[model samples]
Target: MSSERKKPDIQYVNTDTKELVNLLIQGYESIANKRLYPADPLRLFILWVADIMVQQRVLIDYSAKQNIPRFAEGKYLDNLVEFLNNTIKRLPPQAATTRIRYTLSTKRETATVIPKGSRSTVDGKIFFETTKDLVIPIGETAGDIEAVCTVVGEIGNGFLPGQISKIVDFVPYLEKIENLTATAGGADTESDDSLYSRYREALSTYSTAGPEGAYRFYAKTANASIADVKTVSPTPGVAEIRVLMKDGRLPEEETIKAIEKLLSAEDIRPLTDKVVVKAADKVGYKIDISYYGFKHGQLSAEGIEKAAKFAVEKYKAWQSEKMGRDINPSKLNQMLMEEGIKRVEIRQPQFKEVSDTAVAIAESANLINGGVEDE
Candidate 1:
């Protein structure tokens, strides 16, 4: 979930315990027509009562904040989104899916059947099952079938081609099973931040004229894993929507098609607009940098080296997470310095501009630690 946007702190009422106690004591003195000392029984009773009032005030503030979208969380946030005019709802977790190829030992004389729900695995801990039955025709040794993860969410994502080759269910004449495409589209339950962002964009959906924010809202609603979207109109009546998945992964073909279908609906788009949906293009860059630490710094030389390596990884993640972010070595240098590095030399990625429809990705990384030197 995106944390770049900060929520403002809001409170409905004052909840200062000390101030509440003083107020209570003052009221008691005014009503009783006498001063109440600190050690007196009445003063102690007032203090106890003041504590309870403070707790209630704090709860009042919390409950009031839940009614606001920017401060809501959990089920409260879900309810807040539903309050939108378009009946927006929180997105649920989705499973990763890919195509698995079943190879027969030899060409079948008649036909070979791979039943629906046949399971395959890479490490045996997680499983992917065929979505439908597959029939291999005569003279064909293989057939490809769509498979979905048994468990939901991102745990089943990123399994590369040929990685899941082990078949759990026995299929007659099956020689091997392998995934043909990388698993994609797995995502956890929608986070509060992401849902709120969508809720804001959903405000534009009330317009039948099809605004840019309206298209962006529909594109993001297509998949839970979608992190960023850019909408552009290069020509009159032509609307192009670019989608970027979470963690810098490009959207799969299935995701693109889903977005296209949603945006092209008569109720969603204007009559004159031609809607197109596609994955955001990638701008590849490499990370090659050397960092040094101060000799008199708090950490030892070994500690500084470890910290510098971690900083590089963090910088790479930060740079790639957002669409249209430039390839900037200066950000890497700043991160390294923040991690106690005395100096840094970034030699690979110079500052390069990236278009709104493209994302900057680190193709590879090589970080060198130059040990410690005088500050």
Candidate 2:
């Protein structure tokens, strides 16, 4: 269930709120680009929700007097909910997933199972617990039983409405500050007086204080990161490195040609899954989390070597491809994005054509045009 209600038109929102939303959208675009995924929809969904949960959790922990652990062992789902509520304090479920059917049957009279803190155990009755305590009728169908068990107990009690709302509100503020900072820069070189210096100072103050003062302070200097230089990281056994510039700022022809030259000669295996990119507003640094799946490994040197080897081969190939010895970045980028990653960060890369630069160059063309847009 999404809490994404259609908000009123921009005219209805005050200037500040509207500004914040734009900034947030940009941040989302930046983050979505660096993350890579395995070709698993369910896993992708999980990662998406997890990222949101982690983002909110970290924000709350950073702001609060007493920090909370973002990850809870043995109760990932439960802890996720709790963290959301306690940190964000929002009403309704922040995220939800539905399973239409289970591979394992619930109607069996007897089945072997593993019990918590012990090995296999046998029990006459199958019992389950929920947040709320409720009575289960005997001889009830599994579907009916599930309905009866809608006990709203403390499963994710820690996630409350108020906390979540606050966290949700905080993101826009961070974005607003960035936008404001960009507005401050002047055209003249002498006027270029350190956007970086002012940005750091504003960020430090924002960290200690709230978004109120910083929003006004940084608004004038806010500019986006432009694609200038692209960094490709390949550790052994990992996936190849490829990114695309969606914003029109980059010269598509030359960039594509450079990337294509690399991919042709490289030993890099084509990556089918997509990548996810995230940007930190204050630091202006991008963090990309790419996914590569390998067979389960044993706790042995051989297992470690296998993983390492895979990463090395893949990375070297990607590097070679990136170098124009194997494939072009544009083609590799297109293939990877098509496979599902569909998201990438242009990472304020240097445009040899325009010589213009910013923290990031994002494409809004997809936003109004519909269809999945590159983030």
Candidate 3:
């Protein structure tokens, strides 16, 4: 996009409390022919008006930028985000989910009700609730009962393996049933930048032979969290497709099947080509950093650590899994330096590059202050 097409930064300065108070006092003094001190009673009303006006301007500016930032507040923002997601053929990310499977006891002969909105607990976090009613017949068990139950809150719902051992609320005869292993989906709705980026990709590419421009359209089908996609023909008329999921986990069988089905259709893939789909391999990274220097004028220990960690987080997000990507340690060190840290050494990722068939992801980061060692 050209500079003219981009949203320019709005720079209107909203009046602060002091400015509002001074302006009002000046007008009052001009009309009454007397100066009033800051202790005047009417000043409170001025301050109140000032605060409300400032808040109004803030909301106005935020709403105006919805076309750019894509972050919304309250109900309007929620609907906008949802609309964008639906346009992209994926459901909005749900909170943490756990296995809330149901099974009829061997002796129980009748159908049992696993009522809707039933609640489960994973200690140290919020409770998870079922979305719908589940009917378990005789011989029905865990995964067969239903998809996993999700937590009421999104923050603690991810990566909870076998955590829902206790039941907080359920319909009668719950003790006779079994709750199988629940897994966490661990995803957030695609960000505004990600959505915008994908749109640009779609506009730019077409699925032509060798160039493989149109694979993005197929990769983004329902339930597919495409991190990266690569197509290769190991043999004539056979396109070997490897899909890397966004969260670095293997794509579900249904998602894989969907890709195969979509690719097989004559409208998308060539009629003569045989397409095979598979998930990419995940390679985990743990980065340990040793850096020297204070965060821009920050002298305190905690503040320094927080500022430095923030810079590392920005790097991590930009570097997270994309296919055919390599770990650039020099870029990471430079990024930290830009945040006012120097003399850096990246300890993890001893390898120079991650293969095209593999997706590189980091599990954890270890940032050490290194304490002003010789630079």
Candidate 4:
């Protein structure tokens, strides 16, 4: 083995270093107080505690040594800076340097570059890359525009840092804030009742016609119209339309035409109603209509079971659309089980029960001699 001497590890003064460490901790606290703590309060607390612990360890190690290390001195500071730089260099590129990448297109390239330093020192001053583009394209949504403004503001403030930037890259931080608040507050799609109420109010406000009149006019003319009626797989052409009407008869030419006219004119689309008539010619004339209706004389005891299954599926879709929410699977299963039990009970024939002589005899025996003891 080679007899090469190893380098001596640097040591420090425990007491003085502790005091300096405390000062640094206080400084960090002050910085946090002024600049705002991290969004994750737990993470911020953990970081503070960890930093303090590390400092305490350093102080303890330094104080135990014969000669104390000078941390505040220029030479020590330079060494510390070099160590930090070395550590940073050793880290992954993703950990060390941050990059902001975006396609430079006519639609996207409108980034505002704020020059670093004042006008007096513009020549030699280093320019930092700050502020991403915010292009409010024509006919963008209010929320979209709001989100864009938020992203621009964040980028301008140099808040887009490394991995964090990846998350806040396309989407705005403010939008995330809004979403978090919305989620916490349980804000979702509007309810059917609310939609109905709003529509009713709107229809009622129309001049020369009440809500009822409007509804009738729409239902008869525009709302009722259907187009592109076709025979679905495993279903004949005639039965498809008949099942939708629930009248057990094929739709007439007049009926098809009426449905087409109503749908086209009123712009009413009934998602629930599967039966549809498509326009074949000009003036919105409907020809063939398709539906997922039950076949004639096909439903029996077995067929009823199949129909029940279909009903459950249909009910789920209906509830989801109307309530703007989905039913919990566990709750649905329990409900279905209870309903099945109730249905079975309902099917059972009721009969009057005669008094059992044997039970009466047993009760009488129990009453005698303070309830008979077993042998």
Candidate 5:
């Protein structure tokens, strides 16, 4: 039932991309009569070769020249980073946010209006600022407001929006500020290498039917971030959209409403269908793993535990309410052993069939070292 609607990781692709310097050096070495070395003549020849390549503009269909081969001004080396980032998804940085609750100060009877762009900081490392002005009328000064990141990055994530314990940013002029929900969507910009590895991902996206495809609309239009989505039709004309939020955390009310609005839009959702948006129902299961090789030094016990954790994480992402999707311990065992894990046995979670409406969630997996029995 979990359908993805986001950009998939780019696939690995090696193109016949060439560098001017490398090509020039190779050509010089190939010429037996030429002894190219660090000299004015050598420099000139290298510059000429680089200029020729630059003028030729011989690059992959998608490749762009970043630096021109010129010693003047500075060594303009190729900066593929910008080209790579723009070529595919913009690879946007996270938008920081916090839900604020403001109240009219009893001391001042007059309504206090704090203009938009009011700033707040957390330990000087990160800052959250009000997106719009906070207006507390003559009779009322207490209310909730939203503060978004002044900049983009992961530094602004993880705190609850409704955290009342601390008020990091506020002036004496404004009413007391209180947080209402934890900030969850603040994510670091994806790494260049990761984006580079997914070069093919930028070339083509899954059809709107792909798991990532279902999430694209909300991500694009609603500005909502979701972890997993299951698109299903329990019956005809009824589209059951269940989403698993990031890190198993529930989304903000505003986020959920925005998703509903977008999914129910005539252009995005099926015109003939009735859409119901709900959080994915998680089914937790504990896996007891027993294997003989960990103690014998096949891999460190901690390493095996790490492998188990990674496997569980992957499984969680893949689980859904799709028809005929069920937990198979043997498959899990096989996946683990592929990383040098041998003699595996899954003692818990006897396999069973799950219907299309039920999502299988692996809450935890217990690793038993050297086949130790758990009481």
Candidate 6:
């Protein structure tokens, strides 16, 4: 998702109050067959009517814009997607999940059963519950089961192993419980920009033949966390889909599997097509720059330094948010200049071209502020 494309903002009808008032005055003069001065009661009545007409015109323009996919929002966008229910639908918020390990106090004589829906949490604010029961076979000390967050969205993500160790549910003979893997795959509901992008691609899906756009659209629909998708046909009958998660994170194995299964469906993919889904590779880069502020500028040296540091962080985020974005030192310098810096000297990260199947990530940043200098 690149939102670089410009969307049209059209004014379907003029709602200028002054223009509407003039038009109403002209109509009144022609219908009454007499001149109407500004002081006349009839003229005042015409002004009031014009105000109402202007409001109606505004409503008309708003309604027309809502019908357009580029301009639609919220419920209006939902309605537009409903029109293509057969082909695509809006995605809901997804909960984060992680594998939890359950250990017994001792090697049990018989099987130890951890019931489904067992709850565990690091804090009471967020909870994770097992999706299925875990059975430690006879003489086994432990078993692993998958657990999902009780809440949806990104709030439940980023819990490292052992972060969630407290067990809320009582299981007889259970000694300890911990997360075996990091929590991931949580995402918010689909955004308006994302929905519009899919709508444009869905137009190409009417044909059974798998075009690049159609494949990309289906891949995006598989997961809400996906930020960008690149579809290519390396061979005659093979389609490869490369996925990039939001904030430059790679998609987990579960996310890749979900996309693979969705694309491999008999109705979704052509019988001759072999679909492969994988995460986009990352290309590492380092940001090393020194900047100075103008000596005679309004701000103090401390203020300028703070602004420069914030700009560097913003640049790093911009660089990693999109796939195939080249590592451009010129862009970094420009961002610093716009923040009231007098000059910038970039040392590392000379311009590098990133492939469509890869994204550039800034592994480390070295920002040196050289105090103030003459303009």
Q: Highest TM-score among the candidates is held by which one? A: 6
Candidate 1 on 127-180: residue-level lDDT in tens? 999999999999999999999999999898888899999889998888999999
Error of 5 at 343 (Å): 2.0
Report per-prediction Cα RMSD to one decimal.
3.6, 30.3, 7.3, 33.4, 9.6, 3.9
lDDT of 6 at 260: 94
- Model 4 residue 185 CA deviation (Å) reads 18
lDDT of 5 by residue, 1-375 (tens): 112213342322233224667667677768855656767588577877677656455442123322311110111121333444343442456675777776655746676776687666555656677788877777665766788876676566667644543345555655566667766455555443333334333333333322334433343333323544556777977876665544454455555555677777665565676777666654566678776454465567677667666765665555532323676777777776676565677787678776544556666667666642222
Where does candidate 2 stray beyond 4 Å?
1-128, 134-307, 310-375
TM-score of 5: 0.59
Tens-digit lDDT track for model 6 on 1-375? 246326555899998999888888888789989899979999999888888888999999999988877777888988977775546677889999899999988997899889899999988789999998888999999999999999999788888899999989989998999998888878899888788888888876786538888888888887788889998888989998899888788887767887999989887899999999988889999988889999999879888988898888878888888788999888888888888888999998899999988899889989888888888
Ranking by TM-score: 6, 1, 5, 3, 4, 2
Using all chains and alpha carbons, the TM-scores for the candidates as numbered come to 0.83, 0.14, 0.59, 0.16, 0.59, 0.85
Candidate 3 has what TM-score? Answer: 0.59
Cα lDDT for residue 102, candidate 4: 26
Candidate 4: regions farther than 4 A off: 1-307, 316-375
lDDT of each: 0.86, 0.26, 0.60, 0.28, 0.56, 0.86
Clashes of each: 0, 90, 5, 17, 34, 0
Error of 2 at 105 (Å): 15
RMSD of 4: 33.4
User: Which parts of model 5 are misplaced by more than 4 Å?
Assistant: 1-91, 104-107, 121-124, 153-157, 173-175, 184-227, 233-238, 245-251, 266-274, 294-325, 352-359, 371-375
Clashes by residue pair, model 3? 96-157, 99-182, 206-213, 206-214, 207-214
- TM-score-best of 5 and 6: 6
